[model samples]
Target chain A: AQSVSQHNHHVILSEAASLELGCNYSYGGTVNLFWYVQYPGQHLQLLLKYFSGDPLVKGIKGFEAEFIKSKFSFNLRKPSVQWSDTAEYFCAVMDAAGNKLTFGGGTRVLVKP
Target chain B: EAGVAQSPRYKIIEKRQSVAFWCNPISGHATLYWYQQILGQGPKLLIQFQNNGVVDDSQLPKDRFSAERLKGVDSTLKIQPAKLEDSAVYLCASSLDSYTIYFGEGSWLTVV
Candidate 1:
């Protein structure tokens, strides 16, 4: 079975600090990667997705992720963090033929203003 | 568009009781999914529906959990004889094709 792993359980960052959340998946076949964010009381919102294009995918709110196939990783990163970036981030992966997604244990990011 | 819609934002029930949650997918979406999210964990896929037919339900606890998409528009997930461990947020999502899932405000269930 496919599974996703998020190494960082919780991340605290000062304003303007660079952010990176590690995500690794256990799948060898073609896969689709996605980053989703959930605010305090909001639903999960898509940050970005990686299908077949370039490895680096840009998402809304200055978020981006690079899909490295050899490493089986798709890590989320942001150049500068803001207080509004405080939320729970989840990394998900789906096999080519599977419609279901396997999500990693989320990482809570707290950005201090 | 109207993302996805789920009713009963929160539900509380005793163990061995039953509860049901509904989900309305985005307009014209063909694929819908139900996920169970425990506190401090990412959502886990419980079931998947491609229109009115179930595509995958390998993770669903069939003995107590059942879901259906009758008209291919709205879906309902029911948990009979719920247990304390069944307390989680039930998330509904829809996608146009296969990827890019749009999620709704999940239904939180608390099984005491």
Candidate 2:
């Protein structure tokens, strides 16, 4: 069974602060990775996805993640965050064999204004 | 284009009672998924459908939960003899293939 682990449960930061969220998965084969964000009172939307190429994938709203196959990690980073970035972020993995997407325990980010 | 659609945004039912949630996938999407998200946790996939056929349902608790996607479009997830732990958000998602999934505003269920 493939599982995802997110290192942070809750993070408190101020506006203009740089942020990095760690995500590691326990899979060896080819897999697809994703970062999904859920704003307050809103549905979950895809922030970015990595299927095959480019270790570093840039997503919407100045967000980016790097897929490191050696470490089995895909960490999300944002150089500067705003108050609007306060939300819950989830890291997900889809194993190529079964194609089942498994999500990690989410990280609730609070960007203080 | 419109995203996935779910009905009955909220429902409250007593224990051992039955409840159902409906979902309509995005137009032209062939794959649909049903997920259960307990508070403070990420969403878990309960079942997935490729058109009218079941693709994956390994995590579904078959004893009290059942879901069906008929006509390859709309789907219904039913829970009978609901338990207190069953209270969570039922999220419906759809995708053109196996990759990027678009989610709907989940239907919240509270079992009292």
Clashes of 2: 0
Write down the worst ten-residue block by lDDT for model 2 chain B. B93-102
Candidate 2: where are CA atoms >4 Å away?
Answer: none
What TM-score does the first chain of candidate 1 have?
0.97
RMSD value for candidate 1:
0.8
- After superposition, which runs of candidate 1 have C-alpha atoms over 4 Å from their true positions? none
TM accuracy, model 2: 0.98
lDDT of 1 by residue, B1-112 (tens): 6779998899999999999999999999999999999998999999999999999999999999999999899999999999999999999999897787899999999999
Tell me the number of clashing residue pairs for each predicted model: 0, 0
Model 2 Cα lDDT, one tens digit per residue, A14-57: 99999999999997689999999999999999999998888999
Clashing pairs in 1: none
Residue B62 displacement (Å), model 2:
0.5
Per-residue lDDT of model 1, residues A1-113, tens digit only: 88999999999989999999999999868999999999999999999999997999999999999999999999999999999999999999998975779999999999999
